[model samples]
Target: MPFEAEEIRIDLMCRIAEDGHWHGTLGLNVDAQALWRLGLHPDQPTSVVNGPSPPAWWHTAGERYASRHAVRRRHDGR
Candidate 1:
């Protein structure tokens, strides 16, 4: 959310899954259009799902900034 891209902004929408888990929708704002994608794949394999940004000053070589903004899923006790 702290990216310097003014032409594009990412917005997240919270939702509850059928299994009672919380999920978020990743949205891209471009030219007054809201394009959205959904998922909670936070591992390394899905790293490019939302695109990658350079690591912050405090991170190491293999570290990335996009890792901080992951879609957290929660389970509801029935």
Candidate 2:
């Protein structure tokens, strides 16, 4: 039998560099059960891995000078 997939929405507040100055928010659609297995909760504060920066000039500002040091979860005014 085919099973339906369950998805969850999460908000991430990422700090792309060590300076902790530049930050951005991202919305993610992830597998609900997988997130639960990994101990992730909705509206929870957590750290995530950094991906490659976008090719735009403004997007490269934070990544040009320094590497992506860390990422964190953000609360959506809940």
Candidate 3:
């Protein structure tokens, strides 16, 4: 994801729900101790539930819909 804070990064463990739909988000790595002490390697899944990134078209469509609707989910997804 492109943002003003380029140094900030997060690793989102993506997964598909039971509704036969895929959902996942992979962000840039921005950590030092997590890598050194925790050994959380960048660009690597720590578990077998590794999922791929969503297609670009999916993102574009989402953006379009959200823009037209002007709706956003809260932090708790509500």
The digit string of per-residue lDDT tens for model 2 on 11-76 reads 877676566557677787777555544445464445642233234865576676456564534633
**Candidate 1 displacement at residue 20 in angstroms:** 0.6
**How would you encode candidate 3's per-residue C-alpha lDDT over 3-78 as one tens digit per residue?**
2255457787777778766767667865543343333456455653233445698789888988889565433345
TM match of model 3 to true structure: 0.28
Q: Looking at model 2, which ten-residue stretch has the lowest summed lDDT?
A: 45-54
C-alpha lDDT score of every prediction, in listed order: 0.49, 0.52, 0.57
Model 2, which residues run further than 4 Å from truth?
Answer: 1-27, 43-78
Q: Which candidate is the best by lDDT?
A: 3
Candidate achieving higher lDDT, 2 or 3: 3
Q: For each candidate, what TM-score against the reference?
A: 0.33, 0.22, 0.28
Tell me model 1's lDDT, rounded to 2 decimals.
0.49
Task: Name the lDDT value of residue 14 in candidate 2.
Answer: 65
Worst 10 residues of 1 by lDDT: 31-40
lDDT of 1 by residue, 1-78 (tens): 323466476899998888787877788865321121212233334333444444466445335545666554543333
* Each prediction's RMSD to truth: 10.3, 14.6, 14.5
Clashes (backbone N, CA, C under 3 Å), per candidate, total 0, 0, 0
